[model samples]
Target: MSESIEMTAKAPVRSAPAPRRTTPAPRRRSTRRGPLHPATWAPTTVLVLILGLIWSAIAAEHPYILPELSEVGLALVDRPEVFLTNAWTTLSIALAGVACGAGTAFVLALVMSEVPVVRRALMPLAVVLNVTPVVALAPGLVLAFGFGMTPKVVVTAIITFFPVLINVTTGLRAVPPSVLHVFETLHASRTEVLWRARILYGLPYTFAALRVVMPLSIVGAVVAEFVAAGSTGGLGTMIRNAASTARLESVYAAIACLAAMGVLMLALVTAVERRVLFWHESQRRAST
Candidate 1:
């Protein structure tokens, strides 16, 4: 018994088997799609269908009211130079007017945001301008600035000014009270507060206003072209001349060009807004 006990004590202890670690099964990736998935192409598909319908109507009815798409296409293709030159002219006027108007409105908005007195004083005049007919003002502008590009640009600027002023002012004042308090605690100067906080916060609003005013600038330019004496070139001028001559194809062609320009301008503003406001919630949602 003593020998057996000694052997048992000398024997090495065997350990229980270790547990095998089982990793969780890999989770399946979601098959869901974002907002910009292939389904978003529905609008473009609809547009194509509408064009097809129009083509069919032209083929069946032979309508004098609507020129054949091919004829309009040929009008554009044949005199590309004429259309290109006018398009450039109108585009330049719109660009210049937008720059001038938006800049001026931004400055005024800054002032109005800082001073209640200035805002109260200017608000009435702005309302007056907004209410006044742009067509009525065109002749006076022509009389004052002459029939050069100046009048057209001024008209566009006038058209774009109020929208920017309103939007930017609202945006500047839209900053949260907590943010302003934080700035105050930092002993930030007015200029610093404006540059650092207000301007940055106002960007989205400014772009929203821009999206509106950009297309509006085109209309303003065209209206000026229609009425301003001695107006020689632009899509508006082409349209007027073509219409007077009963050149239905040319008229439609110019109209198409104007439509294209408006779309391009809107797209441009949207693209810029996306780039600048990439961190904004709207852009975040769009990306996802």
Candidate 2:
């Protein structure tokens, strides 16, 4: 019995059966394409194809009504200086208007977001202004501000204002209840909550509005240029003068420039949004 006990004691003790190593269920790889992925360019490729088809159709069927794409391109090549100068004029007006409108809207949105009563009082007035036909107001604005860039900038600002206001206000209030509770629990001040939480959350919405307003601002500037009696330069003026003279190629060239401008602005805003919101789920998924 002593020998048996000694033998048993001599036998090496086993560790509690080694815990099974869990290979974490292999994380599922996302099938979604990143921005640079070829698949993400497919829509743009399709759009180019569609545009090519339309160009072909227009060239074949309505040769007189609309000049060939080549003619439009030639117009641009022929008078690059003219187009560039007018484009600069229009762009300046748009930039000024966007700055004014977006700045004012941001300040107002901050106030309205913080004070519900202000939002309630100002929202209807904003809606009325939005609904009032901007085209009708163009002449009056020109008359008031004169035939200079002031009227055009004002028109652009008015057009760009409401979208930013509405979007920013919505974004400011979109904080998750639980997240807000945590902020409150931490005794964060109003400014701290706004800057750290609300502003960050609202960035996506603000960018979305910017994408829209940037293009819309150009349209507003063009509209103002149309009505401003003494307006001397701009794509709108170019288009009007060209159309009056049946210069379809020039008209289309100006239009193409406008389209390019809008696309460029949208691309800029998108790039900024991606950079700013890299941490956002939407952008993260897009990156994936």
Candidate 2 has its poorest 10 consecutive residues by lDDT at 26-35
Tell me the lDDT of model 2 at 80: 100
lDDT of 1 by residue, 1-288 (tens): 999999999999999999999999999775556557676777788998899788769745865677778888999999999999999999999899988988899999999999999999998999899889888988998899887999999888989999999999999998999999999999999999999999989998999999999998899889878988899999999999988988989998998899899999999999999999999887787665
Query: Which candidate has the highest TM-score of all?
Result: 2
Off by over 4 Å in 2: 1-38
lDDT of 2 by residue, 1-288 (tens): 999999999999988987889887888888887679888898999999899789878877987687888889999999999999999999999999999998899999999999999999999999999999888988888778887889889989999999999999999999999989999999999999999889888998999999999999899889888887899999999999999999999999999999999999999999999898888999887766
Model 2, position 130, has a per-residue lDDT of 92
Clashing pairs in 1: none
What are the C-alpha RMSDs, in order, of all predicted structures? 5.3, 3.3
Provide backbone clash counts, one per model: 0, 0
| Per-model TM-score versus the true fold | 0.86, 0.88
* Candidate of highest lDDT: 2
